[model samples]
Target chain A: MSKKINLTLKVWRQPDNRTSGRFEVYPAQDIDTDMSFLEMLDVVNDELEKEGKDPIAFDHDCREGICGMCGCVINGQAHGPDAATTVCQLHMRRFQDGMTLVIEPWRAKAFPIIKDLAVDRSAFDRVISAGGYISVRTGAAPDAHAVPVPKDSADQAMDAAACIGCGACVAACPNASAMLFVSAKVSQLALLPQGQPERDQRVVSMVSQMDSEGFGNCSNHYECEASCPKEISIKNIARMNRELTRAGVRS
Target chain B: MASSNRTLLQSSIVRKQIVAVTGLAMVGFLIAHLSGNFLIFAGPEAFNGYSKKLHDLGPILWVLRIGLIAALLGHVVLAIKLTGENHAARGGRYAVSNSRGDGGFCKKTMIYTGILILVFVALHLYDFTYRDKTGDPTIVEGVNGGLSLGLFGLVWNSFLQPWHSGLYILAMIILGFHLSHGIQSLFQSIGFFHDRYTPMVKKIGFALAILLAVGFISIPIYVNVVRTPHL
Candidate 1:
């Protein structure tokens, strides 16, 4: 069997947000079909470097799909063409030889272009800073089961915990809203006994943060979940709403 | 940025419930209003009389509008909040790519339709309530005791216009798309997915959204296509 194939790649290039960006096509030949998509890009980047041209810049952390950093729209789809996986895990086998790929950064009003393919995702950090954490103080070691929440509740909370803090929800959303991420964080803690102290304040702080981030509002489109690598259910949204409504802000 | 363990947040059932309850309520309002407006088919007096009746109980109408506004705000806000959290939780980038909601047809995009409907709502209110800003929107049935078309002729005349009727039909089509996804998803949101009832609820949702959308659209389509030529 042939071990390598030729391909065409269109990558977005920009020096930084202050400058304009455009697509640059690169020819990839004799590339390992078994290589991951990022690896293929590395091969392309290496070739570009040999020619003294600057390589394309994109974001990646773990490359294991756990860190939730690697992402790009391949052919107009968020995260390439795979379901339930991050872009780092995507392999080149999915594409046929000679396929022309168009890659771009996450397009949203809230997510600005930082450079090349890398986008400014600090807005996410701000949203998290708003209210994504528990206010509990550090203490000596406690029993793992010290907080005995109901088994079902614990399980559901675990599901919310599955959220890897990926911004795919925002990318998938037309409004670029991050309600799912906020709700998941809110739900995960609120479900357990440890989350009680902050329950009243969680919803308000988190929601306010989301709005301040300039992210668009969700219109109840389930696209976030369908494209969500974690498959996080939209149910978290309702739970957050109920909590916010019940807790009703102080002001 | 709440904790990851919001137990209720994980329940798809809760999401469905919220979507269904809110969507159905809004649909109910649309139907009732449409029925009242249909009286305009009787001519200007009927429409104006209906408007007067609604205005007579000023507080009641105000309450209704307030409730409706609350519902709309709540619905949109929750949706936005969830979308934000989801984005943050997932980091807004997938390692793998799959376009779940992207299809070759408009029927697949509830979000798109929802946005369109939102714009339509703004236009709709402007055409009716704030018509004063646009110079009275051409009073349709002005006559004894009323300087305006009297609510009936105003509504009927709205349907009679080619542009207005076109916009109405287009908006309704998008509204239908939004309803089909929203109603069933609401059931899922609130955790109403029993094997015995999930299918039934879905069918019910499908029927209702399509029916309301078709019926409401038909009124304008009929007024424009069939009634206008005859007159």
Candidate 2:
């Protein structure tokens, strides 16, 4: 049998993006240790609903940790304190009974809080739309062997492709830089042969979009890599730098 | 084409490259300076001769001085601009902030240490380069057959003061902290990364920081505690 524990929750509450937010205390009773952190929040919301109070608002989807829809700063760490784990995957067992958890939304000028925890991540979409895709024939899938990707390049590309578009990197960075996210997007394409045609334009456009959206410059803090659920390497950042330089020289 | 080139230069990454390049140039200047300062250990004759040789470079010395000043200005101005942008990016402060242990004290405190070093450099130039101590008893007149600026005597007298030596030692330690993170970061900014070589570079950065700090500190310690003034 899994052990049961209680937690004192201090969650940020705001009516809308236009309003200022403050922490509101809520008691979480009999939370199972095996319960995921979001599940524990679910129980708290249920209790609030039963009492005819406005339930706490948070963003979560595909509780399996792959959707990248769920995340919040838990006790000063993005996606809780567990390394390489998303908020949906974080379990209550990681915490002690009666511990106080301070939860807040991703705080960045680019990611404004919509209500309480959910922020407008449309900035990332804008960056992606800027030049995150390769132009190819859309009707049919190309044969795998036709591309002739090198094994080392394929593996590196796969590693870079693991980013889930989660804003944890922005939340974790002291400067709120999205370099890790932008770099990963750049590296995944730059390392592949299929990404060759528009490679220069892609990096330049994406980086320009990222900056225009008000994200900070990378200071090489490596905090994004530390807090990232995908454990993305900062080497991707260096790769993006090289790509930008290549693009600049060509232009 | 010109507009695109201008855009590339204005981009955040390119600005960082500028900072990194200028920072490395300053580090180069520091290394050359520390090497020249080491000649003080060889006694006043050799030390003053080295100063005379540098002064004899004349126009070349002016070129170097101008280049160093340009690098310093570029580093400072661009760093301040980026720092402001970084501050604005994070719209609000975290009520309870904590580090993930990724960047330690030295990495996070770059601006503070850099500012301190800037202040120290100004004071150092004022004390040695710009100051006139013509009538001071500590001055060794007619040194290096009157061909040198009595730089050795100036340095020796300055370091002999406990407070002056202490200030220099403190500034060197701050510079060490700045370079420890800076040396490795410059390579990263320039897009140099490798599985084996990056780690090696990091180690070299740390070792160089310690070496520079210790080397610079030794002069003051020797002057203040080790060497006895001629009575």
Can you give the lDDT of residue A228 in candidate 1? 78
| All candidates: TM-score | 0.70, 0.96
Please report the candidate that would top lDDT against the real structure: 2
The parts of candidate 1 lying over 4 Å away from their true place are A249-251, B1-26, B34-99, B102-203, B217-231
Minimum summed lDDT over a 10-residue window in model 1 chain B is located at B8-17
lDDT of 2: 0.89
Model 1, span A1-251: residue lDDT tens: 43787899888887987777777889998888788888888999899999999988888889898887778778867677788878888888888888888887886657788877778888778766867777666989798887678998998899998988767777777557777888888889889888888786776767666666667655566677777788787778767766765664332
Worst 10 residues of 2 chain B by lDDT: B140-149
- CAPRI verdict (incorrect, acceptable, medium, high) for model 2: medium
User: Which candidate should be chosen as best, given DockQ against the real structure?
Assistant: 2
True contacts kept of 1: 0.14
Report per-prediction Cα RMSD to one decimal: 7.5, 2.5
